[model samples]
Target chain A: MPEHESPIVTVDIVLLTLEDEQLKVTLMERTKEPFAGRLALPGGYVHTNTDQNGDDAARRIMTTKLGFAPSHMEQLETISGPTRDPRGWSVSIVYVALISREALASHSAIPLHLYPVAALPELAFDHNKIVRRAVERLRSKGTYSTLPCHLLPARFSIPQMHHVFELVLGVPLNRTSFTRKVSEMGILELAGKEPAAGRGRTAAQYRLKEEVSFFHRPLGDGM
Target chain B: MPEHESPIVTVDIVLLTLEDEQLKVTLMERTKEPFAGRLALPGGYVHTNTDQNGDDAARRIMTTKLGFAPSHMEQLETISGPTRDPRGWSVSIVYVALISREALASHSAIPLHLYPVAALPELAFDHNKIVRRAVERLRSKGTYSTLPCHLLPARFSIPQMHHVFELVLGVPLNRTSFTRKVSEMGILELAGKEPAAGRGRTAAQYRLKEEVSFFHRPLGDGM
Candidate 1:
């Protein structure tokens, strides 16, 4: 190996969204060599001069390739297998972002072709595995952590919140029971009445009750 | 650069032990180049011929450096910055191991030194940050996940379990309330009472409830 050659470090963003009762991820068609024209998560080679740190690299990838700063970004994992990238032996730091589906659909600046996770076509490199791992982490940690709130609007009804959990966990919850459990957790606050937007019962909206700092505090027993 | 000189991808193991309620990590005195004699996580450059995958790489490092495999190993985030290693730009897939204090204190196969998270000396590379991040992840994720159970024996009293949580969370829990809450969750079952070992009450021994898989489901108010 030449002493002057430097290993390239890249960043991949797994932006997740919920739409039509299914989880979707934003992907882009690669425009250059080494897996060109394949659907892949938006990413690019990180330069030391520009991306001074891990957080900077993540932000740069989101802004430069996706054309917007992500509201929430987290470092997921790093892929370092020799064949993960073809042009050369490249390492990529993977980060995940959670965006409200409504905001993404209404906003015109976000550059992406969203695809449902269930029907994802062949993705560039090992992105499929990356996406799957991220989803699993989100699903497992989302239960006891404050992550689910990162996926919805500032104010939402209790039923809406239940849907988010159901979708991520891939299970149905009894409405009365779920509400009672959530209420006792003290993670939601009543934010006034909902102006009936549907034909069913007018429901009360809720906001995040409080920031839970305890990580291992167990949930309540079922009623 | 020659084709044979591929960038090295390695896996580093951060073996953690709880010593006197302080989180501690195992470090090795490097015997080779770049930073010889400097303390660092046990690791080596990985190749497919030596082991099957990245996880295997982690095991190899532990076996070669510690002379045994960890009882509980997990995939932590990876460290792949270009400048992390001094000799060349190498990527490291980091993994973590959590073991009980008594287990570590009784072990003799591993020839290594353990240092508290605080009062650490200099490390070989950018491992200080990696170790710190692993600790942060362990502490935070330990709350919402069943990870802490990995640090305990197969059966333990509720008070002992609560004390483990308090030690990791850095906060004291109300004994009466914590026991009731844990029992109410129905995620624990009596394993027949064991005679008291110390000055505490005759604590009833319990193991995690069976078929409690639903407890792992994601929970949150809303996005």
Candidate 2:
């Protein structure tokens, strides 16, 4: 058998963010054939020399295709189908990312549609299924994981962070309880002064403790 | 560009079972190149003619590649990388399946190795990552989903079922509580009289209630 007969696999990034409190995924219109001119996730053939590891592959895809860096990019799942590609048999590793709305507010070259997960139109390849799985991961695992932070800025207030959780989980949380629970985690530290906004006393700003490891906790154990 | 120039995606199945109280994943020694003669998970390329809907691709891949009929299979994730396949840029949809030890034991000449996931050697492409993810899924979400049933025979006792849970989760479950929780789920029905064994009263034989939708429940929320 010749060397050209082997199979190939690649990675695709599904960069998601909560813009205006709605779940949105970044998509790019195709510039090549097969699914050319159609809207799809911003990804291409996985380059060998791009990044050192799997997380870097996602970062590279996001940077090259979307022109922005994601705060957190995670391996969500993989999608493979014999006929998914018109060329031949190919498999793809799909990674889902979360970031703040302001991160990509100015990227216009790639032309992205921040569509809600529920109202997303038919996408190229098996990405629709991929997107659904990402949504499920976000909704279910978001409770316990540091995923909530992915939707907020690096330096933000408790109320702003709480709003992100409400948007993603589709559940309302008591403000007092949420504040107490988050503070006890010791994952955040006060940034000094409070934000000047509507309230009896302005809320304090916080920055995530850099050395803390959030992956050790069991999924959905507590939120 | 010609239609043949496009890339394709495929799905692979990691049919897992418990044999002699040990966890095992189904693998085949490849007769072709690209990790030829090495033990790899049973899979095949995806094509338009295999299934009308993308969701059915997993079922088709199992039947075509391994020559077995599985009752169910769920999409785990997708993997894609330029170097993962030497042929071209391809992606694969990986699915993890669970079946009873009795089913695998009763079947013969399936051309598979029941390898333990923990001691697995370097596999073809990114298969090691795929297997690891599948095992993590089983360990975490196995309780909430109908995963245990997938590892049980058509009719089995509560004790037999609990044994499987123990093997997969690596935890001992209280017999009384396990049975009580399972009964409350209303997802398993008494198939008939239990198998007679030396000792106490014969336990009732039970089978999964096919009507209950197990996927919709929250993960880590059930027994």
Deviation from truth (RMSD, Å), model 2: 6.7
Each candidate's chain B TM-score? 0.81, 0.84
DockQ of each: 0.19, 0.15
Taking the tens digit of each residue's C-alpha lDDT, what string does model 2 give over A10-80?
56788888877798988878888878888788776655544333455666777777776665566765544
lDDT of 1 at B207: 78
**Which runs in model 1 stand beyond 4 Å of their true positions?**
A1-9, A32-35, A80-90, A106-111, A180-194, A197-223, B1-10, B20-22, B31-38, B46-52, B79-92, B105-108, B122-126, B153-159, B176-223
lDDT winner among the candidates? 1
* lDDT of model number 1: 0.70
Candidate 1 per-residue lDDT over residues A131-164, each given as its tens digit:
8878987886666656666677778998899899
lDDT of each: 0.70, 0.69
Q: Taking the true A–B contacts (Cα pairs closer than 8 Å), what share appears in each candidate?
A: 0.12, 0.12
Encode model 1's per-residue lDDT on B95-134: one tens digit a residue: 8888776766666386568899777888898778778777
lDDT of 1 at A213: 29
